[model samples]
Target: MKITVKELRLILTVDNLDELIHFYRDTVGLETSKEWHEETGNGIILDAGRASLELIDSKHAARIDQIEVGERVSGPVRLALRVTERIPEATETLIEWGATSVAPPTTAPWSDVARVQAPDGMQITLFATSTLEDK
Candidate 1:
């Protein structure tokens, strides 16, 4: 299987998009590229790596019957991410910034990746890549 673009940004609609944006900006160091407000709610487009993260404030409206709340997500929260080498440092920074961990980082079998949670309850997974020159 060959693909040019292997991934796309995951979008999560939350109750408080502003709060989530603040956490990602201050705690996780991702920059916001754009923001928009519609009749339904607001949306923030974050410039985490290459793709822009879309956080739409639609949780208040997603509670009809079609949306099934996940184990980690309440309302319409998502498992967003930022690629980092020092998972420990990333986790520590999240803790220092009032982000509560749903569970501590643990290595996933068959892969060199770690999973953690951010405050406002975002599932974060850190994976290792060998494309770094130096940090």
Candidate 2:
């Protein structure tokens, strides 16, 4: 038997729903498709444009951190997003929106990447396909 999955959503169970929503929707510029609230919990779905599901062991995840962000992220999971341009500006914007600047925009093997930590301690990598010099 086979099962078909329709769509994938990255659900972040956050301590402060409003702040997380603002960070992703306003700072990161993802469109908010829907939101819900209950007495016990709340959730928001932001449009990530395109998504890929990756499964890896802890060692591989650490290696990806070393390769992309130049350091090993503390957690078992990391979130990455691809942006068109202005990665430096985007990183700064997120910082202004209350995220911590983990690393400045730098050229990685794949693209120009910037690492930032959300208010809830989620490490996010923002990247663009073109080099920073070109952008």
Candidate 3:
């Protein structure tokens, strides 16, 4: 069988976990449904829609693993979200929400598109493919 969705639990290796949390939580507007912590660690799990994106606290910088058949989360690929209408407004707000744009929002002959670098180094693309709408 083939796969359809991606769920990830990220081990957040950062100098400051609270900053990271604010970025993904308030900036990205992800809902924190569950929270777990120990003496030296903490984590917040997002409802994450169809799939989950979990953020964990780590003191040192190391690579994150992704979910495989036998394992969970080998790593994260740049997550892309598809949206309808108010794309320009949404993207603009995203910048205000603390996402640094890798490429500023622009409209092309084919579509309107924008690129941004999330706090977690995730590359996101926003596109308005009006041609394909209402299909």
Candidate 4:
């Protein structure tokens, strides 16, 4: 048997839903496609552009952590966001929006990456595919 998947939505049960929504939607610039507020619950769906699943082993994850953060900092589930702005600018913007900077912008073999811890304690890695010099 095979299963077909159309869209992937990562639902986060957060304590401060409003703040997280603001961070991802306003600070990160994801367009809000849908939102609901009711007795049952309140939620918003933000369009994150194209999404892809990347599976990596523990060793590889640790290597990536080391390269981006200079240490093993990320847990099993880390959110990697591909941003349009340069890494430094993006990182600074996130920090100003209440994210804690885990590491400075570092140049990796594949891209320029920076790590920040969200208010909900989620480690978010912001990366740009274009070279740092280009941005």
User: On residues 1-135, what C-alpha lDDT tens digit does candidate 3 reach at each position?
Assistant: 998665655454666667667876775567898888899778777654543343554311122111111123223445544446455676777777677766656654445666666666766656666443555
Model 4: residues >4 Å from true position, as ranges? Answer: 130-135
State each model's CA lDDT, in order.
0.56, 0.80, 0.57, 0.90
Pairing residues by index, what is the TM-score of model 2?
A: 0.83
lDDT of 4 by residue, 1-135 (tens): 999988888788998999999898989899998999999999999988777778999999999999999989899899999888999999999999989999999998889899999989999999888333344
Residue 1 displacement in candidate 1 (angstroms): 14
TM-score of each: 0.56, 0.83, 0.56, 0.91
Spell out the clash pairs found in candidate 1.
none
Whole-model lDDT for model 3 versus the true structure? 0.57
Predicted candidate 1 versus true structure: per-residue lDDT over 1-135, tens digit per residue: 887874566677677777778887766777777788899778887766654345555653243112222233433544535455565676667777767654455453322344455655665655444333244
Off by over 4 Å in 2: 130-135
Which one wins by lDDT: 2 or 4? 4
Show where candidate 3 strays beyond 4 Å.
1-12, 52-76, 107-112, 127-135
lDDT of 1 at 6: 48
